[model samples]
Target: MICPFCGAAMEKGCIKGQHEMAWLPDDKRDALFTDAHLQEGAVLLASSSIFKGSVVDAWCCRVCEKLVVEY
Candidate 1:
């Protein structure tokens, strides 16, 4: 996808390292989701039974650091 902010192309691939997110007390370890106001947004896609587990990928813009996800 194209980055709307910087007008640069986005790189398509799975995130290299383990990416963790949380909605509880803000800490250095977890990504704060209070701004999103959604609980359980960040989940283990592989073990999740709610949604059909499938190939998941993430894309990021090299210029603006905007990220997009595909599953």
Candidate 2:
């Protein structure tokens, strides 16, 4: 996939590490782990670590420097 904002090509790969502040209240972390999003599974990849589970898929956008979590 390409970044819509910068037109940069997205790299395909799996990152692994622990993500601190993933549960920040203002971040609305719980929304990312909803049943609808995690119906399949969860694979989280943050700037520091990757967390694989049944209800969350979190990751940091390297190009945009944003937190992206898809459950």
Candidate 3:
């Protein structure tokens, strides 16, 4: 996708790490990802839930040095 802010090309990528959705605040969790894009079969609903690693699709705008995520 193209960056709306700078008209730069966006590269596809993923963010993989120890992301505990349950540990994150409800508002933050909700805001971090779009409900439509979240994969099926939820494994995280609270702070105690854990995953091997969290991978979220994202786009990088090197020109702006910023990341845009679908979440």
Question: Considering every candidate listed, which one attains the maximal TM-score?
Answer: 3
Give candidate 3 regions above 4 Å deviation.
21-51
List model 2 lDDT by residue over 5-38, tens digit each: 5666655444343342233333344565453323
Clashing pairs in 3: 22-46, 22-47, 23-47, 32-71, 33-71, 34-71
Q: Compute each candidate's TM-score over C-alphas.
A: 0.43, 0.30, 0.54
Model 2 ranges with Cα > 4 A deviation: 18-23, 27-69
Candidate 3: tens digits of C-alpha lDDT, residues 1-71: 99988999999996665543423344444544544225344444322226555666679999988887665
Better of 1 and 3 by lDDT: 3
Best by lDDT: 3
Q: After superposition on all CA atoms, how large is the RMSD of candidate 1?
A: 7.1
Q: Of 2 and 3, which scores higher on lDDT?
A: 3
Ranking by TM-score: 3, 1, 2
Candidate with more favorable, higher lDDT: 1 or 2: 1
lDDT of 1 at 66: 82
Scored by Cα lDDT, where does model 2 land?
A: 0.43
lDDT of 2 at 57: 49
